[model samples]
Target chain A: MLQNFIFNYIDCPGIQSKNAGKVSTCAGCPNQSVCSLSSTKLANPEIVLVHKRLSLVKYKIIILSGKGGVGKSTITSLISRTIASENENKNVAILDIDICGPSQPRVLGALGEQVHQSASGWSPVYIEDNLSLMSIGFLLNNSSDAIIWRGPKKNGIIKQFLSEVDWGSLDYLILDTPPGTSDEHMSAATYLKEADITGAIIVTTPQEVALIDVRKEIDFCKKVNIPILGLIENMNIFICPKCKNSAEIFPALTGGAKQMSEDLNVELLGCLPLDPLLARCCDEGKNALIEIPNSPAILILKTIVQSNNFQLYIFLFSVSSLYKFNNINYLKLYQEYF
Target chain B: MLESVKHVFLVLSGKGGVGKSTVSSQVALALKESGFKVGLLDIDLCGPSIPYLLDLEVEDVHQSSEGWVPVFADSEQKLAVMSIGFLLKNRNDSIVWRGPKKTSMIKQFLTDVVWQDIDYLIIDTPPGTSDEHITVMENLRNVKCDGAIVITTPQAVSVDDVLKEITFCRKTGIPIVGIVENMSGFVCPSCSECTNIFSSNGGVSLSEMVNVPFITKVPIDPTIGKLELRGHSILKMYPDSEMSKAFSKIVLEITKSKEA
Candidate 1:
């Protein structure tokens, strides 16, 4: 594990690596010349700094989906808000690592907010005294401007978000990632590799198309050694508001998440049906519990937070990689998630 | 080299899983059924859902003297398809490449694919701004493209992300063909009543705000969601359904806008 560690940073062989420059991975890598050198490996200052910052964070949970628009950001917002409101004493923060399309700022209703750099680092924008957020949205001049960058540039910001963001100290830090297991996912996994990442909550819509990506995302988590906390199937059914006739908006031709979860051996945390009022809350950036008091989706979200898997895993997480949703920091996870 | 492609447009969205592939597949099929030689480029390399949606998942691309021969959806070869999903060793073998590999793959798909003499090329991208978007924009900079068909659901978050997508298109020089509000509502088959289950009209307001054409609002059509109809294009499969009609209208708007 130690030998394979460091994600070889940018898939490079690192400075002084025996396979540097000559390996197929370095074919187009710009740092081939610099990385090909043979010498004693100097400890990366950035990794050391990131470790320093994240050490203060008790529980680190990343929200991921191999597919887009599966409600990862929405779930992150709902869970974080619920946790912050419920556990007033604990600190909770969200790190939006979706460089191209950061959703946390808007989802948390802090879209136009700015990040302030203190002597410590960039202070996260506060939503509540206990809950704050750090997203690229706050840095953009206009929320609508495209962050048209390639992999390396995106990785740079993600690193900044991790090492530079001043969360002070957080009981929970939920990182929201964009769709696909590419640069952003790689960057997050690499930086947070040794950050004692709690586990990831995988979000997906109940359908074969979305499930296909969910499977790949699961594969990614396993490859990166990030424990799979559980799988969340969002928008499972749509009940007509008038007739109350429920229909699968996205038909599970291939058995959807239930079959996939069973096959992948990952926990199926809870299923949230598609509700219009809840959708309205996400769009309006309002708390679903407050806005749609009787919403069924809220009921499911509650179940997921209280789900024994989520609670039980926090404690067992660091003990063994054999388990999923493992070693959850129950108190902190309860503070950040519940 | 894409002299065969007369007009190239992209199926883009700010958020993922909002049916960018669904729209791209149906629109490509609609154009093909209308007798236009269409090419569908699935540049959403990582999550290449187009092959599965279009039921061409089993088809494989072959190398030809012209370049890579695209798999045809129909027997007549009117609809040509290229995607990273096709090059996979197996069905579940995900493309685990980072930005560089994905960027190079998109470039290869653009330059190596032999979409000889196509009327319209629809590039279906993965949601959000990334290397795939940049590579496609840089490569297609010289090509004559009709612009992009931006898709979204009737939700605020999707609209928010799509605004960034619109800005991305503007900065990259791709014009906006229109905004499509997809998965807007659900129509119960038994009750025959419509419910704004996903909310409503987020795309229309977005179009108005961005000053792009308002294409069409496609409801959540369950008929098309059936597993058996996975590879069947909505236009030919459910030609009489409300969803099919919306797709046809979308095609009408695209052609109309291009002509104008």
Candidate 2:
């Protein structure tokens, strides 16, 4: 069923598909399987396998906020649904790195679904036809249970999510990070150094208090050389339905989303208006994108997806080199054999 | 030559829950009382409790064309204070800054703010030698530094860590004036005898081993906790308290050492 879905939905170029089969030999190769293929040999076979593995995957864009209650996970879900809906062929994967606040599964309404794992690796539970979902919440015995882990333990779990999880041929992998520039963000950023970070999307409210800290998060990403793709202002404005007019729920202060992006030299992606229904959908474990399709929050995500296409393309091409392999022409071989 | 401005002294500890901030605040307050212009800068970005300790309100942060101005607790005290906690919208709001942001803010707090012609600036640094600590140490190196006071408890772990902290200061060319042992001993609630709760004399022994001056041991007192919980600095709350007396002695030692 999964293979049929992949074949029908994912558009695999013929040359790439042929090359992938040639690189599949590394699955049986002992050295390439255990250690990184880079350590074993510089041969085309190793390169092909590595490339194939990476190409079959997509660029992982992790949205991280320096602190909590910043609506980071909600933004993650919005981006996932938006990108998935925009590109029908692309498989959008959402991995919630907030082990303690595992809300992705719940937000996507995939809570209580068992994450199936085998000798191969752990597989993400499907949210929709095009979106695959995984979170620390899914593997737990109980969803409400807390994850009491130190830095090293969290790092190990993150590693498993990246290398061990069977995220086959993804277009974009969105990781929703827990708040604070602490253990989780550091671990994810450091571990996935090689993975093309389509970039970080910093979420902040219009209030000076949130911006002060959000500015810090922006500076951190800059220091680490992680491209600040954009700054998103969540809860920028509120519109009253009866009045048919929009009002600034939080008073617009200086050094807000626009000022911050200008000062920091990052793109101001867009702002999300204050929508109670959008919040309610998230609270009710429904996709905010589907629940509030006509909402401005969805519009902002759609714009980000459109603007970040160039980056997404470059990320995909870079990972494509990992899968190229030499193959003998079977038709010619068959004629020669005959 | 006439001294234009008194040098800044930053008191830091290598571990948490060591009363480093408490000591720095009191020392600053004491210097203010001694007729010197003093400024207390709290660089503990995440857990900034300086405002609460000094009993200053948020509206006290005066702003000018120059930038945000530090607040003053008392006119006679003449102490200018600034904390990230004060800049925050709410008191309980957590500061979730990355290393670079913390560094930037620290730099701004030092250079951008209109500190005026202050005599002594006592900086309270967060525990551990993380990026924030490094930023304070590095920036202060460029500035005029009088000396640094290393604080610790009478426990071996804290003593060992503080010695390494002292070594760090020494390596960075920051002069170590002295060491103060906080919670050195617990004064009996019933009897007048002092109990060696954390094993007394560790501060003296460590100071002797490191060849730095052993300032004084601030005994554990129930009133200290009460005053602290009330966001009151010990110097302001209990002017004649034993801890205040010990801190004043240390301040005297620092001034005498600097003069020499």
Candidate 3:
């Protein structure tokens, strides 16, 4: 549909010359090495276009993990749900950059809906009244079909999702990166540099092995200059069916969530207990937040949202208060540190 | 003169428990010994091991008017070293900085640190092409360097997974200077016959296939492990050891290729 829409109105040469030519022309050009514009365009065309449209949106948050089966998608879905639920009018878009394992659509229950392309760009499938969603799963002919793509091919498709899609205005664009800090994560980070990422939220289990790999992910974020928002411990505990009581399935031996946050000085967002109902809802393509109402998991999600909102409020308050005081020294210090 | 500095070599690997830190440390020492004023920056935020490997402690890092001074090797070669380990109060204390904070710190290390009069800045990255590796590539690109060195073992799985890191460097336009096969073969205690326990020659094959130079093979030695456990480097423990000789040879190859 996006391809069809582009073909109908805009000539390929014109749009290509504006964006694509800047990228292709850089090839073998002496200025290619230091060319930020060309590299940014080639890395992520969608993010570049989005920047032009909405200059107000400051940061893009990407949630990533190393090993699969670590509940990264679940954490992504919860974060998006939390952000949209708390902020009434703020527009939030969940872009699933995980082409192979496109679970955001299923987790958020936006499957079977096709992303429509308009004259401006491609529109994301609405998850709720406020939240918009786009995923490779939504565009797939069959949900179970294997993508079987190499790095470059996958990078191109992700670019198309970002550029061709009409995201309009957004306060936050949370990207659900494929497990492992591999090709997709690199491409997303490089392309979305202009978005000035707030930071990444790393999701992991409480096991030692998982923590080991998760540490690497955390270190990776640090190395790349992506501020770490925090760590979310998924399946921190499990509730007993017979007694309806919570028990720590995997003992928090490493104090993983606390230690990681303390060591990294990032926020430990919150932890979610293992719930059968939540898992079933995700499998059945239902919203986990809606299915498990008044649940501990939902409570945790609410708390994280509140904390993030509180942090933002403090940030804005400090800036405005500084203006009122008109203290040049404090202003200079704030500018330097922040 | 500063703008003329090209090729930042960051040594990295995916599989941990491998001697990635040691390889990176030795590379810096060798390069410095070879007359290149190298800045050995340890970007492993969580586990900053370079300081310990080089026998430098937190107290040794002095603050001068220029900036926080790097811990130097005893030799006149003057290998400038910066690490998170040096900044901490205790060597065992954990780094509690979050993602954004860590990124900022790395940027500070690159831009803020007074790394003047250096030809090669060898960045010793943490294992895996995670955020840390990306940060090095991103920040160093701002500095504009020559390439990177990917360190791996002779194991089949290591060779396979390390290629992912190689591909990452290539994607970012960081040239592959070469790959070093660390812990390639084990020497028998009795006969001293080299045994292919993890399958030797895998590194050579992988380098040839990847079309990068097979720098050299470093044999596994118990003495090196003992030295490491004691927080000593091979260059110090056994200056005339085979492993040290191999490292020196690799450094020569790297410098030659860079000049070429």
Candidate 4:
């Protein structure tokens, strides 16, 4: 349902753009080496389909963390659930492109749910009436089965997830990516370059090792020109339920995310503590906002979504007028890094 | 380094930030502490934390007649280390390489890298089962791959990913040596009381579900970070700590012969 002319081809010089490797717009593009000769040469054939399918989505937010296990899927699930619950009228969906270790189905409590296929496309499993989730988890025979795929196979699956899933007229499409700036991240970025990407929300723990990877992730975003919304520091501290005290679980040796954000000049949205209750709720796939409404982690998340100062609340059911959607000016500042 | 290296244990995880590199370093250090020559090959090229974890100084990969020479972690030249971390001109250089580049790099690492006949080669992989993992498995298909030691945290999310990893091991024919549940609980520095901040037994249940050996549970000890920061021997300096004891148990199990 995308307008055929929405995709502006000024940046890319078509398929025969001499060498895509030399083009700044083609940097970090998965098709940098092989730009297939096809329809109009505006983009790749699959990417054109991707644009056609995802043009209905208003905001496409990517949840990325170069370092894994820092709660990328957890935060994506929570945000989609929160957005859907906060606004009853809006339609929100999560597209989990983590082909190898897709956990969105399990995280959203929709494990073992099958994605039905109609004439249009594959239907994402509905976690709630307005909130739906799609992942390779739903397609596997067993939830425990491994997807032992190499690069091309993984890229194929990612394309199907982006263009084939019938995420009909979504207000927000949150994409949960795998760790590292590898196949999945590049494919998603390249295919969705012109999909009116709202921005990316980078997640990380407070540890220096984790932050080091996060810096790589920032570089990747700049190389791909994905405008970053801000950074969310996850698992900042561990608060004990029994002793009523807190501890530095990962121990931010190098001033943690705060210092990194200050040095890198990226917006620090807020920090969420390591709450046991929230972990238990996520383990059971229960709604954190409902199960542990008063927990510190949820309170911080609520503040992030409710506060007007920070940018997270802007993605919420805010007014449509104050808009500077993919301002190319911001990406130019990081072009030197590319 | 020994003349006849025996075991090559791959410390793996399905999710990131679950301390895969830390666990790999601990296991390798434990083997070295036990007087076994060890070679730690860190294939997590994107974020090779091994050099930092082992407190290795920034050094170049010198190409010898055999292949690239690995750096030594100890003065005794017992523990050898190779990582993409050492090849970078700048430590902050982001490895934004694609799959083909990564696969070729990994192939070069496996074919090259003068391990010098160490008793063990611990390959620390990046999270997930992608090209890097497949390339590793394919290249090691001919070798006597000992087994894989899977690492997971107590969180259900981590447990969920571990299940898929177990499947990957099963499909790849890598015997599951055991599973180590890392960061099971946080020990308050002041009160010394442990709390299940991540919720315990997820690793235990995962191991049980897959019928793999549940190695041990490592709790949150901030001192481990200090040891890692100072590049101190994890098992040697913190032998009395709970983490050291847990890894000692893991090393014991992973080092056992297949016939045993």
Scored by TM-score, the top model is 1
Evaluated on CA atoms against the true complex, candidate 1 attains a DockQ of: 0.69
Interface RMSD of 4: 1.5
- How good is the docking of model 1, by CAPRI class? medium
- Per-model DockQ against the true two-chain complex: 0.69, 0.03, 0.02, 0.71
Kindly report which residue pairs in candidate 2 clash with one another: A51-A322, A51-A323, A52-A322, A52-A323, A56-A169, A66-A180, A67-A180
Of 1 and 4, the candidate ranking higher by lDDT: 1
| Candidate 3 lDDT tens digits, B173-217 | 788878888866555554555545455676798798778887878
lDDT of 4 at A246: 76
How well does each candidate superpose onto the true structure, as a TM-score? 0.90, 0.49, 0.48, 0.89
Top of the candidates by DockQ: 4
Count backbone overlaps in model 2: 7
Candidate numbers sorted by lDDT from highest down: 1, 4, 2, 3
The alpha-carbon lDDT assigned to residue A330 of candidate 3 equals 31
Off by over 4 Å in 3: A1-47, A308-310, A313-338, B1-260
For candidate 2 chain B, the 10 contiguous residues with the lowest summed lDDT are B224-233
lDDT score for residue B113 of model 4: 80
lDDT, candidate 3, A32-94, per-residue tens: 444434443353446667456545554467787654445676677777777787787888888
Ten contiguous residues with the weakest lDDT in model 3 chain A: A322-331
If you assessed candidate 2 against the hidden native complex, which CAPRI class would it receive? incorrect
Candidate 2: deviation at residue A303, Å?
Answer: 3.0
